[model samples]
Target: MSISDQIERLATAKANIAAAIESKGVDVPEGASISDMAALVVKIPVFTEEEVFLAAHPVGSYFKTASKGDPGEIYGGRWELDPSLGAFRWRRIE
Candidate 1:
């Protein structure tokens, strides 16, 4: 498919996912949680951890401590993932 076609499909898929999630009564952050926006990223041929972080951290600034990690450091913005970590990292976008 053409690039435009791919983009359109992605956009549609994202919208559908958003609607589905909204239907679930979950408050989705505008630019956080690729999974929250899985409708779009899941359709892509490939995605990266960084992209996930970007998707989850739309504010592009600020940081929060990961619930589980070395018991310190690795703030939310650092983008570290560990089974011990519990809190979801995110950015507040206006």
Candidate 2:
């Protein structure tokens, strides 16, 4: 993929994750990007195991694993960017 494509994918993943968290009633920082959230997740020492896993592989490794049909793919269901909203929304493929 081109650099632009990679960036778009990363942004899409971040937006999707942010939306998911908010759907669960968590208050994400206003306008905070995924990179910001990952930084916080990594520094905080009291995250759940799943949180740690997500934080540890926020981008590269996460996408790689997902492509390989691994846990990363299962964690967030599936996502697509919503251009109108300027963020990603999750959907179940099934």
Candidate 3:
């Protein structure tokens, strides 16, 4: 799915679920939707090879090996630039 589709899914989730997002003991202002949260968050899927590594190291491995390891046929995969990571992250609406 596209970013737009993911954003829409997040928006739909926001409509269905209510959770408080706070920083420094203050809640973020309204109009900040789940899509905004999703923008701030990125999900890196666990592939078969990475599964063992992830099981051993729950935190995550280096991007180079992680990207190359057992990435079986990514159907409808896309990438988004993560400014903090200074790299493109794979994104797919699972």
Task: Please report the candidate that would top lDDT against the real structure.
Answer: 2
Which pairs, if any, clash in model 1?
Answer: 32-56, 33-56
Instruction: Compute each candidate's TM-score over C-alphas.
Output: 0.35, 0.37, 0.22
Q: Write the per-residue lDDT of candidate 1 for residues 13-68, one digit (tens) a residue.
A: 87777776666555556865456565544443455665565555655443355543
Off by over 4 Å in 1: 36-94
Q: What are the runs in model 2 whose C-alpha is more than 4 Å off?
A: 38-94
Which lDDT values do the candidates have, in the order given?
Answer: 0.52, 0.55, 0.43
lDDT of 2 by residue, 29-68 (tens): 9888777776555433455776665665444332321132
Candidate 2 whole-model C-alpha lDDT, 0 to 1: 0.55
lDDT of model 2 at position 62: 21
Per residue, candidate 3 scores C-alpha lDDT tens digits across 1-94 of 9999998997777754334334223343467666665543333233575455344433322222235322224322233322335343433222
Evaluate residue 5 in candidate 1 and report its C-alpha lDDT on the 0 to 100 scale.
100
Ranking by lDDT: 2, 1, 3
Better of 2 and 3 by lDDT: 2
Compare candidates 1 and 2 on lDDT and give the better one.
2
Question: Higher-lDDT candidate among 1 and 3?
Answer: 1
Q: What is the lDDT of residue 58 in candidate 2?
A: 49
